[model samples]
Every structure is written in structure tokens, then in C-alpha cells.
Target: MENHDAAALLEQAAQLDAGDPLARYRGLFIGTDTALSYLDGNSLGRPLKRTQRDISTFIGEGWGGWLIRGWDEEWLDLPQTIGDQLGRAVLGAAPGQTVIADSTTVVLYKLIRAALATVSDPARTEIVLDTDNFPTDRYLVEGIAREEGLTLRWIEADPASGVTVEQVRHATGPATAVVLLSHVAYRSGFLADLPGITEVAHSAGALVVWDLCHSAGSVELDLDGANVDFAAGCTYKYLNGGPGSPAFAYVNRRHLSGLKQPIWGWMGRKDAFEMAAGYEPAPGIRSFLSGTPAIFGMLAMRGTLDLIEEAGMAAIREKSLKLTAFAVQLFEAWLEPAGVELASPRDPELRGSHITLDHPAFRNVTAALWEQDVIPDFRAPHGIRVGLSPLSTSFAELFRGMAAIRDQLRR
Candidate 1:
């Protein structure tokens, strides 16, 4: 499987696919046409076959048949119910700590604001983050800092390597109130040391918030074990929840009582159905919710979650490492000779499910590849992301995509 020759690598890919334990699960998802190579799963995943059937069933039976009765029977707690299922299968969190609602931006804002509200020290005036974080994350933190009159401690992460634990330690201190960062860098595909950074931020008396938009279902997460104070992520990418799927928010059970999310609505109030005047926050994770759940959008994710739970994250991670490793092997043999450089971390353990390669012509190369039915997304400053979704992608498919990149570079 580690052959340095392209023809040999293609042979190895087929051999690897023959024995792949997760190979059976690929049929569960849609978009299996051999004419294309989908290397953008980190941006948007393919919908599950079951998702279409489930959506039809929901509309016909759950919504159409039950009418308003659906709320009392199942819709009222869809957020928390699905959150628990996601927590158990992907997030490594216990029940009652995660809830699905809002977009990634809204959920991130709520969690960041909730953490900021808990800061009691006047000296804690800094919000630490990296320059390479996702655009929405940076915007939300900048907006919050400007509105709250706080300082932003920017961590200048290497665009290729991402924010490291030492960078976090140096950036956070007594002056830092909240440290926000991506669990995986969106552009470079660098996976951060979640537990180590959380511990460092805690020692500095700052709460940590993670944006899991890139890493959520692609990598194994232990929010509880890492002692992550707050987290927000989207279900559209790795979770395969469809476009415009509801995002999730996680608050450590210990912080539930004290955390005050900025947006308070009737849904977050205790006895919400009673229509009380004063807003008494609902106990536990429900208080983090600000509005009615997106029940329709969440339906597709359930089928994908079922597949994830059945495959197990450990198995998925194992397959991910292999696929990415094979990709790297191909790059060393073919793409590297064409002056294409690896922008993502070379160490497999330091990388996420995706890999980024840099070529001066990548912008145009991406455009050309799209015309030829090989898809990889172009990032700014000459980078192309090769995102591998373990359940839907095969080693042979990965080879085809990498070979296309190599052929285009030769042209």
C-alpha cells in the first residue's frame, strides 16, 4: 500500500479497497458515479440514500399525518435528542450537554458570548485567537471584542502548520478572558492539540471555545475528556446533514448553571409553553437553544449518524489515516516533482481528514480539473484541499483524483 510508483500505487489501492472494513458503508451515501472524484467532502458531504427516504417518510407520516400533534410527540425535543445521538456517536460527550440549533455562526456567537459573560475579573480583557481561523469565527470574535471593549490577542499561526500548543500558551494569560480557535484549520487541514491547549487556557483562567466546522465528524473528538468549555460546529460537511443543516452547540454540564447565552427567547425559557412574563432560563442544554429547532434539516443527519455509530469513530479514523497516507505517498511520487508542495502537516497524526497541496498554478489548475470532472477546492494563496470522507471515498478513487492533479500539473 505504500508503493512509490504510480502504477503500483493504483494496484495497491484496489487491493486496499478489496479488504476495507468500511467499504460496505460507502453504498449508504449517494453520488457514487465513477466519472467524478469528489475531494471536497470537508466542504459539503454527499447525502445518504436513506436521507431521501427518511425525508419522504417524515413529510408523509411525521408531519402530514400528525399535523400539530408532532410537536408534543417528537418535535419538541428533536434538538437535544439528535444532539445526544451525535454526542454518543461523534463528539465523545455525555447526554444533556449538546443541542442542535441555529447555524454555525449563530451557535458560535452564543457559545462565545456565554463564555465571555462568565468572566468576572475586570483585568481579563483579552480574547485570544489565530489569524488562520475560519472567517466567521474571526468575524464573530472581532465583533464581540469591539462591542465589549476587549482586546484581541492574535496568534500568528503558520498558514501551513496552524496554531500550536506553545502558541496558545504564549497568547493566553491573566489578561485573557476567552480563547477561541478551530479544532482543525479550515485551509491547511492542521489538527490542533485540543486537550493540551484546553489545559493551558484553563491554567491561565480563560475559557476555551472550539470551532469544529472542519473536524467534527471527520476526526475523533473527546470534548468531555479534553475539558473543552464550549464548542460549536456544522452538520453539513462531515456529518452529511445536507446544505443548510442545523449546527450543534456543546456546553460542559458543569457550566450549564452559570452560562448565559446572549440571545434569550421563549424557547430557552423555563416553562416555555406556559408563556411567563419574566424569562427564567431553562435548566441544562435547552437554555442554549434560542429558537424552534430545524426539524426538517436535522432529519437527513440522523441516517448519516446511524451509519457513523455503526462504523464507530475508531474504525473511521483508522481508514482516514490510511487514505490520507496513501494520498501523501502519491504526492511524493508524482506531484512533488512538479514543484507542488505539501501545505498541510506531513505527520499523519498532526493532520485532519483533509490535506492541502500548494502549486503556483493551483487556482487555474482547480478550474481546469473541475472541467475534467476531478474536483478539489482551491484555497487562497495557491492551495488545493483534498478532503477525504472515509465512508464514501475509496483508495482507488483517491488515486484517480491525485493522478488527475499530477496530469494537470504536467500539462
Candidate 2:
């Protein structure tokens, strides 16, 4: 942890990279350059090299050739197909409980509305949310609360440590209808106790909805094992899905029977071609779908999910812990003395794949780093998010990125 030892950080990084089992996986991405250090994979993951072939094939063979017929044979089933793959490979969920469609905001809106319907009690009209949740999530919850006349119970969590199980327990009560929280804090990379928090919400007769935007592919999630009621996440991050790719939603089988999503479209109707006048919801998870699947948006995810299936989430998670921990160690040694503060949890068990460092000069530093092609996102109030994707990021890349930050600060 000493600066003298830290001076050899680059050499240490090379040694770590040489032994990393997942090291070769980094070459599979589109960008494996030695000069460019992409530190924002938690925000947007690098595309898989296989994705280029997949997209080309889709354009020529899948879309160009099949056209309308593709709808029935393949395109129509993409939502459920990819959803099942994601559920099995990454979510630890069984089939029929997950589906991919719409953006994260839309999916979250539908799931939240569906969850609200399940709670028939007029008195249970409060929605509990953390203050530091993603802006879109907070906005969606705020809009829903205003329209439904529900109260918002805000849990003010530390930006560094995030919302703890104890904080969640204190936030929910008899009046709590639903608790919306992010599995990993977006700004600080704080990993919440999913199973523990879910139990506490259920104990108070409230259903919990998790936003897996930051945790989906980065963390090892067991939705079924955790007995999570509902969840939504974007595929563009750790899943390596392309920008603006459609998000996924999961509903428990128990809730699927009676869950009534607000959006009632032809896709969710039992029979679409029949053109029935009356509205009848489709059976099971299909009801969660209200529009045509984002076939093009989902194309890249197929390749990424294939890689995830090959590597296994257990191994991916193991690497994520080491990568982030190494970043912390490097931060403590190099950046800490350069007036950089560790904004993320020190304990790797309590954190996600990324680490945050805070300094007053980071606003301009991040801008300058971007020009130098060392990309790490800057959050307000001086936090720089160092997003490390396990499959795509290497220790040498992490060291170079951190060293660049250190060098920039000294100037």
C-alpha cells in the first residue's frame, strides 16, 4: 500500500494480466488497443468482435432475406428468446419469468405500474426510493407517484457506501406499497444486499423492484434464488449490447398470473392477427410485452450473451472483484497522495465492478482525460467513475488509466 511499492504498479499490472484466466477475453472486444484505456465499460461496454459478424448476418440473411417472414420464424421470438438466454446465463432466473423489450425507462414504468396494481390496499400508498438512484429511475418514480397520489419516502444514503439493508428496513412500513432501488449504486458502485433488502420489503407487505442497470452483467445475480418480485436493466453496459439497446424485465411467476401492466397493446393480446375488438391480456410473461421487440437493438446482445454463457457469471464476478480491488489498491497508493479521495466502498464485497475517485479538479481532469482517450465518466460534485468491465478490461489497462489520472493531477 506504500507509494514506493505503488511506483511499480505498471509492472504489477502486467504480472496480474499475464495470469488472468479471463485475460484473453479482453482481445475479443472491438477495442483492445494499448494506447486507449476505456474506463467507462460500466456506462457502455465495448462491443464484441463477434457482434460485427452477427450484425452483418442479420442485415443480409436475417433481415434482408427473410423480411416479413422473419417476424413469424425468428424476429417475433427475439424478446423471449434473448430474455431466456439472459435469465439463464446472467440473471439466475428460469424461463417464463423474463422478457426483453423497450428502454429501461419504459420497462420500469410498466413494471412499476403493474406492481402498483397488485397492491389493492388504498392505505399502502407510499413508494420508497433512495435519493441517489439514477435520474431516470427517480424521475419515473416521481412521475408515477404524482399521477397515483402516492407519497415518496426517500432514503438518503451515503454517496460512498450507498443504501444499506438497515437503511432499507427503516424506510418501509405498513403504508409502503413498493420499494424501488438500484442493485448497485450508479455513482459510487455500491452493491446493495439484494436478498436481505428483498426480505425486509416482503416482511412489510411491500413488493421490491430492483434496477439492475449497473449490476446485471457485472455482478452475480440470482433473481429466482433471491425471490425478487420484479427487475429491469439495460443491456448496453456489461452485456456489451450496442448503444440504446432495449432493456429487459423480470416478473415472478406468482405475480405473472395477476400482474396487470399499464400498457395494453396488440403484442400483449392473446391473439394479434385475429383482430379482436375487446382487450384481453395474454397469458403469463407475454403480458409484459406491449410492443414489437427491438430486433435490431438486440442484435449485439446475442454475441455478448454467448460470451457470458461461455465464461460463466461466477468466473466473471470473480474477475470483477479482483479488477475493482486492484483499482482501489492503486488508488490508495497513487491517487490518494495526489489529492484524490476514494469515493467508493473500501470493501470489495460491498462494491460493484467500478470504483469512484473524488477530487475538486476532476471536472476539468475528466474532460482533459477524454481528449487523451482515457475515458472515465465524471459525476457532479467531483466524482470520476472508473468502470471496469471484467471481460473487456485488463489490469494493465486499469493501471495505465489510473496512472494517467495521477499524472494529470500533478500538473
Candidate 3:
């Protein structure tokens, strides 16, 4: 923990980063406008240069020139096209099982409602979700529970450790129709044991729906291998999709035939333009789409997805671990004695790409850091989240941010 040891550790980290196969991807993003150390990719990712150009081209040609005709050309396929890329790159889903659609909240609502309907037994009327789930997810579930006259079985999760397979098992019973959780916890950055959790849920005859908002781009996900029943995630986070970009939903091919999304909009119907008298949902993931696709938002996501595919999740994950490890090392060496406790798991295998630290004045400290242009997020009751997007953050940036935090705390 001495200065010499910290320096040496940082030096070794820099060497590893330099030799990393994914190092070059850091340049693919707009890192900063004025040397800003952005440690908030878990909240919102840096915009890609390609996204700017792609938007410009789409605006000028696709929308400006082609106008409404663009729909007939390829505008209609945006959901399926981008959804397939998402499946191939991160979701571990087959092509037809994913589709770009509404926000994460909307997708969660649709999937949860659909799962509720599939459970015909009135006795199985409880929806299981962790108390530590993201606010939006919890809100959506609460709304669904109210609408369906179902009770919610909320599992109390350890703020630092997040939900575990055992916690889920204890919460899920024969009367549980669904088990919902975030793949990587939002505040703690804890990576849940997906396969094990899925097994537990399935054993109790409950369908599992994962909110992959944190893990999709920061971690390697094999939804198909895990036999996930359904999943949803926002692209604007680690995926580098621009702000408010359309989120995605995954419906396993097996479930597509059996589970029906609640929203039966014409866009999700087999023949969307047929103006049919009744709603006959489309097959596969396309049925998850509820309304007209956001052309501009999908274009922004396309650029980021291209970059993600090029860098590859394997390489991205490698750099992500390195970045987070570097930050944790710095905190232990410099800030631990000052009462700063690591809230994230020490073992990288149990964590995602971000690190969280606990301090009494976390909200104030985070705000102050932002004033100095060091951006990390704060969760209530004192946790500072430093998210390192492998494609945009650097070891040097992390070192500088930690140093700033240490210096500020000393004052």
C-alpha cells in the first residue's frame, strides 16, 4: 500500500492495457471534450463518431430524400436488423428472438405481463423481484402487479453483495409465476449467477426475465446458453448507443410460440400494414414491437453496435476487468484508511465493469467531483459508482480520478 507499490501496480496495469488486444477500441469513441475523466458509462456511454455521421446521413438521405418511402425500403426492418446484431454480439440469442423496441420500462412491462398471462393457474399469482433492482424496473413490476391483482414477493438483497441464487430460491415458490432480476446489479455492479438463478426459477416452475441494462455491453452474456426465458436491456449504456436510444427485448424462440406480449399493436401483427380487423401477433421476437420503430434512435445504436462487434465482447471484457481492477487497487492503496470502503466485490469474477465505494457524504462528494469534471454516480445511503467503459475509459483516466478523490477526501 506504499507509494512505491502503488506506482508499480499502476505501471503494471498500464503495460497490460497497452498490450491489450482491445486497447485500440478506446480510440473508437469520443473520450472527452476537454480532458474530462468520464467514469459514468454505466449511466450513459460516450457518443460514437460514427453515430454522428450515421445520423447525418439518415437525416439527409433516408428521411429527407426518401421521406415516407423509406419505410418501404428498409425503415421497417430497423427493429429486426438491430435486434439481430444485438443477439449476435451480446444477448447470445438467436436472430429472430430479439427486437429493438420501446424503452426498458415498456419492454419490462410487456414481458412481465406476457409471462403473467402464460401462468394460467390462479394460485400462482405472485411475481418475485429483488428489492435492489433498478428503480424503473421495480416501478414497472409494481404497476403490473397492481393491474393483474397479483402480489409481489420482494427479496431483500444485500446492498453490497446484491442478489444471490439462494435468495431467489427462497423467494420463489410454486405460486411464483415469474422471477425478475438485473443480470449485473446497478449499484453494486455484482454479476449475478445467471445460469444458477435461471435453474432455481425454472425448478419452481417460474419464468425468468432478466434486466440486462448493466451487463449487456460491459460483460459477456450467453442468454441462450443460460436458457433465459426472456430478457430486456437499454442500449445507451455500455453499448455506446446515444441517449434515449431504443432498448431491446429478447423472447426465447421456445417461448415465442407460447408467450404473447400484452401490447398487440398492428406493428407487431403478422401483416402490420394489412389493417386487419383483429390482432394476430407476429411470430418470434417481432411480436414484442408495439409501435413504429424509432428510426433516428436505431441509427445511433447501429453505429455503436458496429463498434462493439468490431472490438468483440471478449476483448471489451478484458479491458473492462483491467480498468476496474486498476481503480480498486488505487482505492485500497490510497483511500481505504480514510474510511472509504469498497462496496463492489473484490473478486473480479463476481463483478462487472464498474466499482462502487462507500462514504458517508457520497452524494456530496460525487457532486463535488462533477464540479471538477470527474463524473461518477452516487446511489442513496452512500455509494459512489465509477463505471469504466472499456471502449472509452483509460487506466490513466482512472488513476487521475482516484487521485482526485483521495486529495478531496484529505481536505
Candidate 4:
């Protein structure tokens, strides 16, 4: 595709976007006065109008009126409430299995340690995780291994292709205590075969903990159907929870009864307010809680989850594939010939809601795009990530951003 030809195709994409069913959702976000073409929704989604209002109400009514009594009003139950909504809406898990608290890193640490403790055999002293898993996940796992004197088996995955079920099978053995992986590759946006990988880990007598930061709100997950052991994710991405919103963790119903959290804080005690003489874990997933909940962050997540439930995960995923396909098509036509390579998968089914492109000048190009109010993120070793949230991103915005990149490259 020549530069001129690519420009023409982008123009055509704009025309097609006008009739898209999800087009109107673009208006629901808080747009900037500048020409900000935000393609980084995978990192941090644009705040919804409803979220702003909810935050106001929370501060004014929930905190001011209820005061410390807010605990009795509904603050304590918000975690489970939002968790149930996230489960029914996206996680595909039963109630009492999901709770919203802490960040993704904290949740990962808690779950990984708990999982490792469960497999207490001396031979099971190894943790299996992909090299391509998010940096935070890898770091957390490494820290756990160091603390527990366990071996870290890093599965070196193809940077662009992501981790596979075959690779996971090869890496897992009798010594594998826990298998940690991300549902979607953060750099390549490749969606892992969750069910297949989970089956492989279980076959090796190991538990699996999935980082759903990229997949929770953007993809349709059947954690219950898949019999996944544990999971964690953030609300700030496609979930449209505000930045720094609370994260969620999930333990399978069957595992919830037996699993013991390593961080046994007061909240996880059977009678939290009893100020008990000894620690007695509460029944089910509540045992995972460590400290006081972030009420404001939880409220923000509640507002976002409400929107997700209303829209439905199936619907969100359907439009997500379409949006990513549209961006991939645009990239193939426009950037391929300009020394830009598609870093993400070409197959729609294997990809997530983002399309990544690789170029030698990606760092500079990304900085230039930001100056022009086109917001796409730069990953390490020359990769530019364009994250399109299906609920909020429009075809026009995608085309505009890609066109800007093309224009900048030509100069």
C-alpha cells in the first residue's frame, strides 16, 4: 500500500464508521478540548459522564451525610456487590467468589502466595510464568519465589505471538506450584487460550492464576465454565473505572472454602469487628481481604461495573473485535509499506481490542503524536500500542490517529 493509497483507504474507513452501531458510545466519554485522539484505552480508559456524577454523589452524600456510619449503610458490602456484578457481567463466576479491593499487583501477590502455599510438597517449589506476562506480574512472582526459596521457570514466549498452551504444557511439570499468565498480552494484544492453558496447568497438578487486566471488560470470559482456579484484574482500563480505581480478585467457588490467604489481616477474620484474640478466616473469598477497603475507589468501580452490566460483556466483546479489526485493516493498508510492521496478531480471534505497530522511530513518533493530540502508547523495544475501547472508541478517531501517524512518518 502506497502512502497516497493508504491515505485514501483511511478516508473510506471514516465513511463506513458513520453507520456503525457502536458509534454513539463515543459521545459518552469526556472528550478533551484539544484534538486528543485517545487510542490508549487499554492503559487507562476515558472516564464516563456517569462516573463523574457518581463521584460527586459519593463525596457529598455517602461520605458527608453517612460519615463513619457509612460502614453500616453500604460501604462494607460494596466490595462484594461490585464483585458480584463483575462476575455476572464479565468474570462468569458465582457470588462469594469475587471481591473488589487493592491493585492488580496486590491481588496477584496474595493469590500467587496462597496458591503456592496450597501446593506445599517439597518437590513443588517452582513457579511457571511467561516472560511476556506483564512486568508487574513477573516482578510479583519473582518476589514470591525469592521469599519462599522457590525456583522461577520463565517461559520465554514470542514477543509478538504471546504465550501458547503448548508452551505452557512444556513448562509445567510435577514441580510446578503455580502457573501465572495474562489473559491478553500487554505488548502484542494477543489473547491467550485461557481454557486450554488452564487445562494444561491442572493436568500437571498445578493451579493457574490469570491476570485479567486486559481481558476482563474487553473480552468474554467464562471462569466458572473453564474451572479457572484464580484471577485478578484492574477496573481502570476497558471497565472505564477512573484512574487508580480498585482492582478485583477471584477464587473459584470450590477453592474458596479451602484456600487460606497469606495476608491474614483483620478484615479477613471471621468476626472482623470482634477484635478477636486469634485469627480465624472468614468463609469464602472474603478471607482474601487484608486491610480497610478503598471506599472511594470501590464506588468508582461500582459506577463503571454498572455500565458494563448494562451494556453486557457479550455485546462489548462483539464490538471490541470489530473495532480492533477495523484498526488492523487500517494499519495493513496505511503503515505496512512505510516501514511499519503490525506487532499484533492478524487473526481477529487471536487478538484483543488493541493493535500494536513496530517502527524504529516508535518512541519519537509516539511523542510527536502526543504533541498533535493523538494519544497512543509506546512499549519497549520499538512498539506503539493503539488501544481501542469498543464502548468508547470510534472508527473516525482511529482513522484520524492512524492518518496522523502516516503524515508524521512521511515528514
| Candidate 1: tens digits of C-alpha lDDT, residues 165-203 | 899999988899999999999988899999999999999
- After TM-score superposition, the amount by which residue 52's alpha carbon in candidate 4 deviates from its true location, in angstroms, is 1.1
| Cα-lDDT of candidate 4 | 0.86
Q: Could you give candidate 3's per-residue lDDT for residues 268-303 as a string of tens digits?
A: 898889897988888777888889998787877777
How much is 140 displaced in model 1, in angstroms? 0.7
Higher-lDDT candidate of 2 and 3: 2
User: Least lDDT summed over 10 consecutive residues: which range in candidate 1?
Assistant: 1-10
TM-score of each: 0.97, 0.98, 0.96, 0.96
Which segments of model 4 are wrong by more than 4 Å?
1-11, 32-34
Better of 1 and 3 by TM-score: 1
Can you write out model 4's per-residue Cα lDDT over 1-411, one digit (the tens) per residue?
466876676676767577666666667678833367899999998887877888888789989889999998998877888899899988998888999988999999999988876776789988999888888998998888888898999899888879999999999998999999999999999999999999999999999999999998899999999999999999999887777988999999888877877888988888899897999998888888889998877665565577677878887888788888888877777788788999888899999889889999889988898999999999989999999888788777788898888888888
lDDT measured at residue 108 in model 3 versus the true structure, 0 to 100: 91
Q: How far in Å is the alpha carbon of 282 misplaced in model 1?
A: 1.1
Clashing pairs in 2: none
Full-model lDDT, candidate 3:
0.86
Residue 258 C-alpha lDDT in model 4: 79
